[model samples]
Target chain A: MTNQLSLQQRIQMAFPGLAAAYSVDGLLHYRVEKSRIPELTQFLHEKARGRLALLFAVDCRPLAEKYEIQYLFAFASDHPWVLLTIELAGQDRLFTSITPSVHAAQWYEREIRDLYGLIPQGHPDLRRLVRHEHWPKGTHPLQKAFPWNKTIGRQQADYRFRHIEGEGVFEVPVGPIHAGIIEPGHFRFSVAGEPIMQLEVRHFWKHRGIEKLFEQQTLSTAIALAERVSGDTTIGHSLAYCQAAETLLHIDVPRRARYLRSLFLELERLHNHLGDVGAICNDTAYALAHAHCSRMKELLLQLNDRLTGSRFLRGAMAIGGVTKDVSAIELSEIVALLDGIEKDFAELESIIFANASLTDRLETTGVLTERTGWDHGVVGVVGRASGIDQDVRRDRPFAAYDEVPVNISLYRYGDVRARLRVRMDEIHESIRLIREIRANIPQGPVAPAAAHRPQPGQWALSAVEGWRGEILYFVMTGEQGSIHRCKVRDPSFVNWPAIQWAVVGNILPDFPLINKSFNLSYAGNDL
Target chain B: MFRILKKSLKTGIVTGQHPHADQPAESPSQAVCEKAMPFRQSLTIREVDTGSCNACEMEMNALANPIYDIERFGVHIAASPRHADALVVTGPVTVNMERALKDVHKQTPDPKLVIALGDCAINCGVFKGSYAVTGPVDRHIPVDVRIPGCPPRPAEILKALEEIRRPASWK
Candidate 1:
């Protein structure tokens, strides 16, 4: 609380007459002049030392005659989020770009330009970020006037991919459709001999207009959409969305439900991390580790199905609390399952580390230095692997994280091996967390009987540290308590840009290994 | 190496029996069964993701894992569409991927089948009315079979493929 107060004082000292209101929701809203974005965000990012977590635009027209741009900076300390708001009149379509000063604002600026048609005046690369070539010009889907179901005619426009031209430099284009059973995105690699010189990823091939679709949904129905934001992080996204809804609706979740939410979040993490550990080994042609890991992952998914009705743990999270409660018998069953997997995982971990050949492929392969990680604002396991040493569960505790303190595993190597180690460590930690939650879990009603309607114009920002990274949701309630604008920042949005830097000097075949190490979500990023 | 060998030996064979080993084949699937008759013996599948949340892809990948190992039943995921006997597609066809979906469908040769792998692919489940959606897989291509579920379980998917692979037994 003192840290938050001092931070507010510092911000007030920096900007005279700014009147930065620090609300109970942990948001310090500074509604500033449009011209002050670059300086304000740079000051907060560098001086205040906050990670630029999310930047998005809300089309507040018809309700209000302006487009509100929100730049949310999350702190490594107990300090609250500094939300820098720049409202532009409906007629004014431009705001000064903060990308030149604060590098993390690059994609957010371009995305705002694409979705809301609010151009960032001085952005360096203003080429299309979200929209494809065929999307008709002047069709900003997020605007209030644009109906969600309206169809626009397609147009032809060529995309200009970054070119590296020289002798022995060859360009290889791969996938809007990959050979593997994964989501689609195009990768253009500029390679010479074996090592890649520059790699550009063209994505958003799976944009289902999810953000606009949120506007048409009530708060209850929106949880289903949130669960699908990234299927792998089903609990993570829905939990964040539900927390935001709970905050807006002023519904307090019961103690047992909060504990269950934490437990399930760890379960989701365990399965994904275990799968990646096996996948990274599989990329190196080590089939033994892959086979065991796949079996372990299958067992975990089956357990999830037995406990919750969904293998991926969808429909597990509700608005005020979790949908289902675990009985003593089910909890014992989970304990038994974890006990068996714990021994199996230990043996598997030994085998993986024991093999020098497997370790060689992982070490020094696809290194994303700590500096690069910070520059790109990478979050989650990828960021921790690169020595960021930040976890939202510890930094800003949510659910039952406050009661059961989180132990974060960090590495500085920032290589494929570093990423693998981080994941392995996290699996161990998740197992520990589940055991802790089961032992200390309080007995109570899972959810409240009814949730009161949120007032229009009320908004809340919720962040959950998903298995992949940090999943942030900025939700606002509109008239009739409908979702006004729900901006989802899947960790992939920030982390995807950093992959280009990671694969620079690496060989082409090692690309899959490095890519799998990160395992970013295309559906999440595209949405 | 000794540890791996020991572990492998101790674990022993884990491959399970086929979905229809104990009982007779259930009723033949819908109209798609006639179309599925050709690939009854062995089937090569090419999985395409139009715009799914990736749950379908997760289950599809699970089919290849040691537990399911659909390969024992002569079902394989081909590296290229050209080698595929059927295209197992997932997701509601997004506008961005509409052209690519058609191009992939066109590339598959004659007597090829298209299976819409999840609820989203069959009818754009939750994303039906969104402007960015072009529609389901059937809107773009003629779907031979539809596997229903937010993402169908690997066992359920195996049973469907088994029915497709052995349509005559069910008939």
Candidate 2:
């Protein structure tokens, strides 16, 4: 850790001519020239040894002449991200896309193309990833001066996916609706019989302009929106936003409140992972494991209701502090619950993993290699399974996470089984974490956010390792109390590509198990 | 066939209430949990998705499920705007959804109850200031209740709904 900090300091010292540092919380943000981004990122990717995860651009519409395309790059090197913003004016809005350089930047580049109307100079497969074709011309909503009222967030289907051509590679069109109770998303699967040739995920069913809405609401209220980005990962995303707000406002929640937030965050992980585990079992047609996991999850959910007055453990997290203080008694009950649940969960897991039939489908299926995993910039269990040891909790701790140690489980399988195992391991880790936090649960004022309002122009980036993955939030408020703009990037946005990749080499029937294993949030990404 | 006949012979009657063959059919808490929203007045609510993906819908569905039993709070969700009193909206009210959102609020009856359910609905929490969304529910509609979370748990939603009607219900 010391070597990393000093090495970064040396680099910053050397780069005084080309780049500078902006520290947000404990994470360092080094802004470099656009021309130097690839080199800098390559240095970080190679030297940082895969600490680098996602690279995406955001367009900042200033009153000035030039358009700003900012590149955000993070590393697993236990160092802060180096953000490089380049000014694109005239015809130069097109910079050479980084898709060729890093695989993960592929989707981010396409999204930048759609929202900011900037094309990556040489982006491969540069089609409309989102914003179906026929969006009214001369207006990119994210662009500054695009009148707020002029923007119409319409869900229009546009353009056909370019399919891979050849004999026996027939197209299998499914969804906008599926057999199960799932969200609206169309998947274009090209296959020869059961084996999938290629899968193109057509998202944007529930794409409401969440970012645009945040442009107008108060910080406290906007939190409600963040929490809803993905229901299951509410605290995951909420913790990110809340951390950003608290950091931006320079508000430090009470110690007890911080511990409380962490408690809910871990609890959120427990429930979601348990649910995912159960869902995967169901997909594999393992009724015994499926039923047992669901029952276990039900017990947890019911316990959550008794402990926090909510089944999904919502309303427990506020901006600076949590909404309600979890009592010592409840904490003890949670500990007991975790102990019992962990035993049940492990028993079911062992039985499933040991079973020959279950292992056959899960093993060697939906293989995403190390290169592909890094390239897609996948996060959470999916990323970990693919040998990307990027957990926001372990990498970048927020709230009371700094004090609480977390176990980041990593694997190299990059398949459905790896994903499932990562989730299972994470649940076990969550149980351990719950027990620890309960033992060390502090006492103090649980509410400290609304007490002191932050002065504007004091921007802060607070990130948390959410259950799904790393949830990143950037907050910029005006000199007054109002916010100018804030960007919420859930890991789902980056992980969706991995989902597409998972469909490769897998039978059509096995897609359910594969999808369940990853279970990327469509709504969270759409927002 | 003989095994089936033998199994049937163990039971006295064909129409016997069960897992409770040994005792009563219901647990004590089950009665109250099974009852519909325990209020005299039902809060007419409209569910709007400003920019959420649908995790909220999962919890929203669970509200009416036998377990959570959201109807026990006199909170029946209304489909159309004109028929609603409270707005139980999710998502950040992304740019494209701005118009429909405003219209929904306008069409709703007076003294409307608005709830910003889930993290997205309350603050556009993460999607803050993106180009597409225009809300946290409060931007387009007056939010009377706020259930914070990505998708507020059913219990949280019920609590938020309860908060909205509490003052009036007392009156």
Candidate 3:
């Protein structure tokens, strides 16, 4: 691990024009001129080999004279995060666009334009990223001026989806209202017969103004808000929020609480992977595999209910540590349950692999090339499937992940089968992790006494390797220990765009299978 | 195939017999159980998620699994509202999804039952006061039944569905 002094020195050496810089919890925080943001970010990406973890804007008018844009860069090899913040002054707030060099900044810049009304001067596509047409012009939701419960009467406007003009090209516009029990997202597929030529997705149908809602709540209540960012990713989002709060407060979570948090995270990964595997099979008309997988997933949910009060593992996390603790008997019971689940999973795995027809449907159905995956900054299982060898748990160890090393599963095939293979490998790995955590169960209190209020003007970044991918939460405190801005970057937000690339050559019927393989959360992205 | 058959036979008859026999004695909240006796037999449900966390959807999905097997009770999840006997909605109604929710409700035939699953649909549970949220499902559309939880368990969902299926006199 790179120590704070050397990390700060390395940053200063690389960017000579840095105005001010400091290090907190080993993360290097630097402030640079607005004009130098693009150049500095490009240098960090290319020279420092820093991955763009999160890019968000904060309406810091209360604390400062201007708004601030924060760019979080993580060096996986060095395991340190460098946050570059730029302040925009004057009425017409503008900053140089980094999207031309860094492709991942496209959505983030557009979102900034939509929510905080900050203009990324050269961003290619500045169409509304968060606010729909219903939102009145000049009204930015994330700005502190916008009331949390302010309503706008419905306004209608046509979203001009990209049109592929050619012979025999027809467009199939699917839901904001889907047939199945799934969240709403609009998919515009310009196709020739069955093969999809071009695809465009418009989400935010389920947007509940989650970030704006966070501004209204205190630190403790924000945990509840974070848990619902996406229900399946309850632990991942809440833990990221809690970790960010803990970091800002400088609270050292007990070793046992860390272990329990890791355990819950793995358990969440287990159930979700099982469910996704089954859903993929179901998409291929392999109902039997789905049936067995569903049974196993249900069992995991039951276990979660028995352990935590909620099946989805909500209310299990606090700002300082976790709210619940597992006794020895309950831990043993979980171990026994895992034993049974593993055996059943192994049998189901054999059956799924042996079935040639099912595998045929999955293989090469939705191919997301390695180049596109990297360019788009895909993370988690989808990224691993495309051979992007990055996992937050392994690279930037959070919670107890540093103690228990994760064996990352990667595949270069970039197809549905490869995605499924990655998920299966991860399931086995998660089961192993759970067993290891259960055996080495530490003895201590789950949480500290009551969490104390964080100091004003403190900012912290937390990232968790959620079941879907890397869930990043950036928290900054403002006047009298209240949250100034809390920006959540769910893995789905980054991975959803990659799906457009995955479905290009595939037929329309394979869209659902391709979608299920990615399984990006609509609520997570919409938030 | 033979192995699958053998496994199926080994795990025989896991489906619950909630319709024929009363579920094993457990304290049933009058709010959920009193409503449960009416809708005992046939139901075609169309679920619309306005802006749920997807936790309710997971529990709803579990109702079709082997243990909870809602199909045996003649409860089916219809893909179209036109064919559905009931509209099962989840989540708080978001501004964008309000149109679709009302459209689905309108398309469902008369004498339709609307069951709001999860606390979001019941009263905008956790997201009660967000600007983007129009309100709970009932604010826009009349909901005949409400299954409450951050996300109600599968058993609770099953009971609520069964309750709505019963004749009006039973209720």
- Can you give the DockQ of every candidate in the order shown? 0.72, 0.17, 0.61
Best candidate according to DockQ: 1
lDDT of 1 by residue, A1-527 (tens): 88888889898899878886556646788888888778888888899888899999998866799999988898865788888888898599999998988899899999999888999998999999888978899988898889999986899899999999999999999999998888999999999999999999999999999999899999888999998888888999999999998988889999999999999999999999989999999999998899899888988998998889788998999988988999988988998899889888999899999999999999999999999999999998999999998898998889999999989999999999999999999999999999999999999999987658878888988989999988899899998989999999899999999999999999999999999999999999999
Model 2 is docked with a DockQ of 0.17
Per-residue error for A518 in candidate 2, Å, reads: 0.4
Query: Can you give the lDDT of residue A115 in candidate 3?
Result: 84
Residue-wise C-alpha lDDT for candidate 3, range B14-126, written one tens digit per residue: 56622232342333345544344444568888888899989988888888888799888899889889988788899999987888888988998866778888889988977
Ranking by lDDT: 1, 3, 2
lDDT (10s digit) by residue, model 3, range A172-217: 9998877787888899999999999999999998989999888888
Which segments of model 2 are wrong by more than 4 Å? A9-16, A23-26, A50-66, A89-92, A149-157, A449-458, B1-52, B60-171
**Candidate 3 lDDT for residue A337:** 93
The interface RMSD values of the models, given in order, are: 1.4, 6.9, 1.6
What is the DockQ ranking, best to worst?
A: 1, 3, 2
Better of 1 and 3 by lDDT: 1
Per-model TM against the reference: 0.97, 0.77, 0.95
* Model 1, residue A482: C-alpha shift (Å): 0.8
**Candidate 1 lDDT tens digits, B4-96:** 888889777766622322222344456666777777668999999999999899999888778888888888888888888999999999999
